[model samples]
Target: MPFELEVCIDNIESLSTAIAAGATRIELCSSLALGGLTPSFGFMQQAAKQSTVPIYAMIRPRQGDFLFSPQEFDLMLADINAAQEAGLSGIVIGALTASGEIDTKNCRNLIKAALGMGVTFHRAFDLCKEPTTALEEIINLGCERILTSGLAPTAEAGSEVLKQLNELAKGRISLMAGAGVNQSNVKGIIQQSGITEVHLSGKGFRNSLMTFNSSNAKMGADEVDDSQIPVTQHQAVANVKAVLDSLS
Candidate 1:
């Protein structure tokens, strides 16, 4: 198979744009501002109804960190069940120990709960203290793929480690390079990291004019309250197309 491009979409508008742009797959989530939390069941159902491409729903309950409390893990389990029922093709999730290692038991339980559905370990792998060790453990636990920035802030900085991971993975699991990937650098990241699959969020933000009334505004108060303005952006098809074109 040729290299695979997975687009991350934050909303329905972006989902449509990505599909139109020729994306073969999508990872659906809410609140990209928070690095993606689980989308609602209704949203997942709507996306599945409208999208021809496979949609993988993010299963994270909150942001901030990858370490999940027992209740949060349970919530994730329920989310996975809901996603399965709503017709998602797969799920993206990750968990880590307080000491910064893969939470194998929780991961294994999640994998089992998925019950033949596709599972991609999310960028939480980058937060692990030992990525190579975590990669090995996830592979052993039967994850289908791992979305990573190679334990670095961006794929470019982590290219060498990602290359090592790609070689070591050896078809056992997929190493998908993401984070700060764009048309300009995707080709280099792929070439250097030796990864065939890549993930990108072709997103652009737009400021909303709508705002809440603030009675507390004073003469000296700042004219614009940053919190009152909502920013909206979605995965664009053109962004995905550009990356594909660069790879080709």
Candidate 2:
């Protein structure tokens, strides 16, 4: 199969950059520092208007654990409906039990709700107590792919487990390595894990255009510089795509 690079982006600017830089797919979300949350319906609609590649809206209701409350599940269902209405191509989603097992029932419902759209089970797969078991469950749930770091903090660190998962998958489902992926290490991760697909934000920070700053105005976290906005760098995305193309 041909290799694919899926770029994750949190804003319109980054969405444009990723596509210009050769992303085969786009994972649209909000609050990347919070590990990505479901984007607003307006953002989804605008992205659909701008993006050339297939855009998969992240279906996460919050930033914490994937064990969602019933209310949160209802919110996710609503978000899925909104994504469909916005003309998105698919959704990236995941759910787990408190004990670290795949929440099969909830996931099945999500897949059913997302019916015609392509489904990618997100990184909550990394938290599973049993990777192989979770892999089977995800495939049975009809997820077309699993985006994971192989239970480690980064794809490079988890390359071994990623390789094992790839071998076990045996083409049953696509295994896409993500988390801390960059141009420097992407080639190695793909080589070691034997996965044809990869995901990354290719993120970089830029100073806000505002020339004035008020010391008392702190709407976000105390440490974060609200003036500095996160953007997906076109060069960063291009470099990784070049590396993938260079590989046999």
Candidate 3:
């Protein structure tokens, strides 16, 4: 079977670029630098309207950690509902307990809220204290897929554990290799991780549109300042697809 490539998009430009470049699936988000925050309703609406491929909007309320407060959890469920109402194909959602295990209670609630829409348990899987045990519980929760880098910073580096998880998954759920995936390493990642679905941003940095010396101060919480914004490259997306196709 041909491997599935799920492009991670954060804006209308990336959305158009990915769609035009023949992406069949996309993970729609807002601040991908913050590990993907929930997108605005208007953004979701526009993406759904313009997209020909399946778009799964991220359900994260904020950046920081997978551990969420009660209020934050509530917000996540509300966001899931809104994304579904916006006609998105799926929702990427995940949360962890303080002890570093899947918050089955909250996660199941989110899944229940999703109902007919597809559900992907995000990279929070990498933060679990007991990953193997967590996998069985996640499978029991009926998530459509799990996006992981095998508890490593990158899928290529985590290929060993990624392959192990795929074996344990045993077709009960899909294991999508993600994080630091690029054209040069995509082929090796697929061969070693044994994953059918791969997730990446297909993005490159662009200088701020401002010609003026905009702001000497930064606004973003992390090191990802606005000076260089991530924009998807149509050729990058196409190259990933082309490389994957060549392997098949």
Candidate 4:
């Protein structure tokens, strides 16, 4: 079977780029620089309308940590509801306790709230003190998939852990290798981790042009700062094709 590639997108433009680039699936998000945040309702609706592939909305409320407060958890629940109503194909989320263990109760509640929608436990799996225990908790919560980097900073560093997790999963849940995954190392990650599903952004950085208004200038200096600008370069379909070729 062909390995599956799920691209992580930060906006409508990125979504369009991912689809054009031949990504089979997408994980919709915002603030890619600070990890990711939940995309707005309108953004979700627009993405669903524009893409043919399944888009899984990221449910993270903030960028700090996986641990959430009661209020933050409530916010997450509300976002999930909004995303589901907006016709998202799935959700990417996970929660942990103060002690860095899976918050089974909170996770269960989130799973229940996402009924009829696909659920993927996010990288919080790597934050748990014990992955084996966390995997069991996640499986029991009925998460359809778990995106991980084998508890390491990158897939290459976590390949061994990923392999172990894959073995322990035993079809109970999908182990999607992510974090620093790319064409150069995707094949090695798959071969070592034995994971069928993989995640990547396939993005590069581009400089954005700065616009300045002479009329609004003060002290003869341009009102808008143009010294530095960087933007994400959405991968082309050929990038996806390259990864697919490596898998074959």
- TM-score, per-candidate, Cα-based: 0.88, 0.98, 0.93, 0.89
- Which digits, one per residue and each the tens of the lDDT, describe model 2 over residues 96-162? 9999999999988988999689999999999989889999999999899999999999999999999
lDDT of 4 by residue, 1-248 (tens): 67778888786767777766667888998877677799999999999888899989999999988999999989999999998888989999999999999999998898889887999999999999989999999999989899999999998889999999999999999999889987677778888888888888876555445465444444423543434222334554356457666667
Residue 243 CA displacement from its true place in model 3, Å: 1.3
Report lDDT per candidate: 0.84, 0.94, 0.89, 0.84
> Tens digits of per-residue lDDT for model 3 on 72-129?
9889888888888889999998899999999999999999999789999999999999
Model 3, C-alpha of 53: deviation from truth (Å): 0.4
Stretches > 4 Å off in candidate 3: 207-227
Weakest 10 consecutive residues of candidate 1 by summed lDDT: 227-236
Q: Which ten residues in a row have the lowest lDDT in candidate 3?
A: 213-222
Query: How big is the RMSD of model 3?
Result: 1.8
Please give, for residues 23-100, the per-residue lDDT of candidate 1 as tens digits: 778999987767899999999999999999999999999989988999999999999999999999999989999999
Best by lDDT: 2
> Global lDDT for candidate 1?
0.84
Span of 10 residues, lowest total lDDT, candidate 2? 213-222
What lDDT does candidate 1 reach at residue 7? Answer: 84
In candidate 4, stretches whose alpha carbon ends up further than 4 angstroms from where it belongs are 209-237
